[model samples]
Target: MNLKDEKILSAWEEKQSITGVHKITGYNWQQIAKVLSTYGIVANDTHEIILNLYDRGKNAKEISKITGYAETTVHAYLPRVRPAYNENISENAKRIKKYRQNK
Candidate 1:
């Protein structure tokens, strides 16, 4: 690998997000991932990457774009990691009722 590629790989190995690596190296996430794969370096799982991005304050859509997962999938898995907020039992019931009705 060239010196520049080596630096980018080092940054990726340091656990920098694909976005961070892109910013520093000018290589998009897909290209970086492909290169990593060629070196037999496996990337993180979708759920783990999504949760990390979410914890860093990225919304579901942004996380989806970054991680290449469907937004619906991200939404489905997020509630498992982050607690759902309900102002009251009534509000929770109302939401459930609405959801059931929609279904």
Candidate 2:
């Protein structure tokens, strides 16, 4: 997907609520959710908050602060989450590198 679509997905993931995402993106939440389905992302599962936060760019320390989970516990859960935390981090790094190159 292009940057705009990525941003929309990012916003959706960050908000973690259909209405919240819809309000910001001005797109129907269902449509946004459909896009998420295509990406294998299932939004708004409370049990997945840690994983979701990780996907939205929160590190173990950050997630720990937000979720009251210990940093080590967050680290433990990272591997169980889809895409793996390290892989997600690498992908983010690549995105940032490409973005910088474009700039």
Candidate 3:
């Protein structure tokens, strides 16, 4: 972790709100959320998109097509998928896993 992050954690331990931390660090809530998740922080925005797609039962490739992000990128964040969400499968999705996976 960088010095800024260390300081942010210290501030957080002192009960600083995320908005406050963002103000001090100039980092978005998502970036800060990722850091917190690394330490087992459950409330972060981690898996937000993954869960959104997963609930809809969209595969990594389908999510990639819809999101324009690499399938691997979507797959990589699977671990963070929300524990509770819809689990319906996506239909008529174009498979683009190869292009993204090879990268």
Candidate 4:
């Protein structure tokens, strides 16, 4: 690969957002993504990357920063990838319902 392609690949491998890399390299995200795909580097969606990072113990705020998404958006996706989070919410709801019935 040429130096420009190499730089784009390096930035992508480093987990930098496409938009962020584009800002630094002056190439649009589509161009960068096309180069990555050409080299067999499958690009993942921002949500999927966020979920993986969350599984790795990164919080919503940190994931938001890395993925260039709002913290609220990251939090919204957490339940989809984190079964434990959904379970906890369900358990809390059950407990609240039981408490109200008992009272």
Candidate 5:
């Protein structure tokens, strides 16, 4: 790993009270969390706080504004609740495909 990633890993390993990697690297907090997740990091109180903030009416931008999270992090944690977000187009594949093929 590069020096930056090494530092990020150090921060996670230390489990410091708050995210310290963001201050010294291009990595954002969410990106750090994503890395932690990739390595099987368990959920913690901070994760719960993120979930709670996302569950409220606040949009990602609003969550970012209220919380200290980066804008990207707020967005990363706050999608997938809308009907459009959950929509699936693969459900009617057979009928749709037959009609299209006949045409």
Candidate 6:
């Protein structure tokens, strides 16, 4: 259960969940949990993983696909996940347009 294992460390840095790391590395949950504990990397729960994925620029739909949550559920959690979440797609578009124009 060494954090020095490059494959595991890379997955952790990518914010992959324990299950994801397991899938990638063929490690069981216990081994992954041990590594997590040894390295003080708190295992991310579902809610936190969703937020982390969002923070990494995944949209609700994408998060839904990754997490097996419905799109509506992802949408429902998003605002609570981050304060000042702009649900207005058009507003974001306008801001992006303006920024690009200025640039």
Give the higher-lDDT candidate: 2 or 6.
2
Residue 84 lDDT in candidate 3: 21
lDDT tens digits by residue: candidate 2, 30-73:
45655555466655553267678978998889999999867765
Cα lDDT computed for each candidate against the true fold: 0.65, 0.66, 0.58, 0.67, 0.57, 0.65
Q: Model 2, poorest ten-residue lDDT window?
A: 79-88
Please give, for residues 19-71, the per-residue lDDT of candidate 4 as tens digits.
76776788876567556545655456754676689779999899988888888
TM values, all candidates: 0.38, 0.38, 0.38, 0.38, 0.36, 0.37
Per-residue lDDT for 1-103 in model 1, tens only? 5565586688887765666777878876656655554454545576467667877999989988887888876664453332224423577799898999999
Model 4, stretches more than 4 Å misplaced?
46-103
Clashing pairs in 6: none
Off by over 4 Å in 5: 1-42, 82-103
Which pairs in model 2 have colliding backbones? none
Per-residue lDDT value at 55 in model 6: 77
Which candidate ranks first by lDDT, i.e. highest?
A: 4
TM-score of 5: 0.36
Off by over 4 Å in 2: 44-103
Model 3: pairs clashing at backbone N, Cα or C within 3 Å: 55-86
For residues 17-77, what per-residue lDDT tens digits would candidate 5 score against the true structure?
A: 2256566455776566654543445346655566676657666677777778788765544
Candidate 1, which ten residues in sequence have the lowest lDDT sum? 79-88
How would you encode candidate 6's per-residue C-alpha lDDT over 76-98 as one tens digit per residue?
A: 44533322234345777888979
* Model 1 stretches with alpha carbons more than 4 Å out: 46-103
